[model samples]
Target chain A: MATEAKRTRKNAQSGIFAVFREQEAAIRRFVRRISPSSSDVDDIAQETILRALQAEREREISQPKAYLYMIARNVVRDAMDKKSRSVIDFIEDFAPESVSSHEPLIEDQVDGRQRMLLFWEAVATLPEQCQQVFVLKKVYGYSHAEISRKLGVSVSTTEKHVAAGLRRCSDFLDRRAAESGLNETRRRSAGKGE
Target chain B: MTRPEALSADAPDLTSEAAAWLAQLETGRLSSRDLAAFREWIQRSPRHYAEIHRLAELSREVNILAGMAEPLKAAAQRRRAVQRLWSIPVLGWGSLGLVATCALAFTLLAGMPDPAPAVPEPVFLVTPVGETREVALEDGSTVKLNTDSRMEVAFIKGRRNIYLEKGEAFFNVAHDAGRPFTVYAGDRSVTAVGTAFSVRWTDRELVVTVSEGKVAYGEAPARAAPSQASDAGKVMPASSAPVSSPRTMLGPGHRLEVSPLNRAELVERLPENVLSRELAWRSGFLDFQDAPLSEVVSEMQRYTAQEIVIADAELADLRFGGVFRIGQTDAFFEALELSFGVNVEQTDDNKLILKSVN
Candidate 1:
């Protein structure tokens, strides 16, 4: 009986590792998406998979894919906390001139305006009802139930409207970005000719 | 180059799918099964990760602009006008209210300079057939114009006035105790300090529907004396009217129909559902209950270029009832043919003739 138990434990360990091997790339990608500035993406992803495996040993993970992503997100958060602490320490060692001011930088100001323009342009492409639904929910911060009641629509309809709005806005922004990039290249080539 | 071209062809669909997922996640009510499905979806391709990452970044940037939610809402409401101005793809922000809001938010956040004050001007707004438009005025009021509508807005000194030249319009007047909001339609005018109502004018009659606070509806005071002929056809100043006329006060759900020729006025109190049905065109729908086929055809004709004529007089009074989209003439025709045994024929002049099947 003791030998049988040992064999079962060994098989479970191998099973978890095999699953981890299959999901390693996805874990890394999720980590990178969550914390794009992090340089330790691979390390954090590996740590997340190992921790997930440890949890699997304690209990059955019914949805292994979701479990892996949830763990990856937590691992990224911890990594960010550690990095922010180091950053704070570095700032503490600097002089007054080295510290950034409370006021936003000029580039940040430009970026804010750009973002506003992009948002408005993207929203303009939606239908009137969808636009109203999106603005009420995202800008006015109304709950889905409140929006449905106010707009005299069903909650399910409101959800569909919101999803449609997001998809259209995303597509609009992507197209605009691509078009502008193409224009920039064209202008550069023309300037070279001049 | 071929590889990149192939990827770009399918990129938009993938991006939209990712955006849908992000929206679901935002609802904060996703089940465990949904999360598992999302995981499976994301692992399908490396492109999925890229699309989600791009959308996530875009969503975050949008949240940052939520600090100026009022302006964003206004922009969304006036999307048609913005789209027209922005069609050039050059970044020229046309809405003064939006610019002011952005400047105010920027000033509060980054100590930026304030934008110049906007000068009040007479703005003429028109909507084509089968279309509706919503405009947000500087005083926080919103006007939703129905299909094929025309209106002129002028705000000066102590008063706000809207001239409904043609078609119908609904106004949600912001509470401004100092200024009374008035809409002038044909021979009638409706005035309110703060209320929500709609005014519709045709050649033969005028209709006013009050959905919110009380409003006074009566004959418009005569235009200012000819001495101010320079302002003829222009928005008259506030001091033009000294005559006091009898005005009828209307409460919520009250609809007043006035015939200019006969000088007859009728007021009826409508139920909530009926009122919503009357105003359904604001949301691009028309609701009818046991109405005559002629009335439905005329109403539907207003939203389409095609003229609908009843070939048989017997079918004119046929009772038809249903809710339909305003501009979907094909679907309406299909329903009529399938359910009502009506045969629809199209003529070369873009007219539709309805005839009985038997």
Candidate 2:
């Protein structure tokens, strides 16, 4: 509760917010480099920056970049922990192979998890503006009119961007599916071998 | 390439086309031509339907993302000041430490000058069964809480938010262009600038009826279902993007009814007279126009602890219409028996069972 109050107080300060906006692009790119997918870059960056701010408030941080990297590392670890718990639901439809297996079937899950990350990574490959519009409309829950106003674009433009994002993301996924035809073949062979 | 394709090769083109239709759906104005075209497209192949379903799933994913935005925004605002301090390499070690110390002092002093506005904690109000309460908010808005309803009101820095936890409430919101007022009910949110609207939450379904002004109603991240009908029976231009489910704005005399179980949404314009009759509870009256026996009983259940049931399935469908005072259940039963020829049997456990007279 004390830390929550402290974080709230720090958030209310304009000085920290100004610095955050200035360094946002850099932080985003940093996260993208190490991120499993672009879809999670913003999230990891946000978490890293928030933790860095908290650490800065607690003590003097000599090397801020190193501090940020450490925070991102921790955030990623936490996210992985959370993902493993819910990964079963995500892989339920994709991995019916687990049902036939007698042994604890751990290796098959690795492939399923990889495909799941790939699906989201394909979403991260969308053009910057398109991705922003998609995230605003889909993730941030902004309406077309609200997105138009926020992004300084017309309503028609917002709609176009959303459509473009959907097309591109779906195409990326399809392309990945086509390229990974071997995976399907291997899985089928594995099933027949059983 | 050997296996059956999950999506057709033309999936991209079809999805793009589906995206256009999805956008058109959100505009709440589907022309007969567009509707016919969409139907034709879907009937052309199962692939088209599959594409639309994927689009809907994607939209739901977006809604889930919206749920995480509050925390993302808070954390995204806090960036390190070390960038500015460390980027300047020209300063010697002594001056570098001096600069860091000054920066620290400036940061601490920045918040000391002015006091921030105090944000009031959210206040929860509840109404017991058979009771209705009216409350005036700090902004001079009024909320009339209906029987067995609960709501929480929070007025923060730049927004007025009300969470409709259970039942129904009629809101007379004060206009503030600087801050929007939003009512969160279930997975949907109804936002208004200045409007009189009633939001009812029952069995995980949300019913929003607007009496005055226009209000936006929809699910998070635009995953909302499309409006079934246009406002006041007047269809806007079909060229506009379709508003998705759980999301749509309604004008005066417009109502949005969403049932998640079936993912069905109905947005229709009503006559002022009909709207008034449907919402007669505001004036302490129960108005029914050929309502079924089951519906009438459920309405009665909200007012009292007494349970009402129809003994025969056929009796449940018998329609009854009348206007009666809220507490006059005895009169309601007497009139029903005399006109509808149904026998009312009261049990010792306060259960009223309606049976058809043979």
Worst 10 residues of 2 chain A by lDDT: A86-95
Model 2: per-residue Cα lDDT over A94-171, one tens digit each: 323324323234334333323333333444555556666766665444457667777799888888887777667656
Q: CA lDDT, every prediction?
A: 0.62, 0.58
lDDT of 2 by residue, B1-358 (tens): 2213444454537778877766555434468897788667756655555455455433333332321221112111111111222243211211222332322211211121133354344467778787665565666567777788877675665667776778899888888978778887766788888988999987677889999999987764331322222212322212122222335779999998988598588999987557876677664456666577789888877877778888977667666555544454665776556445568889998898888643
**How much does each candidate deviate at the interface, measured as C-alpha RMSD after superposition?**
18.5, 20.4
Candidate 2 Cα deviation (angstroms), residue B92? 73
| Candidate 1 docking quality: incorrect, acceptable, medium or high | incorrect
Highest TM-score among the candidates is held by which one? 1
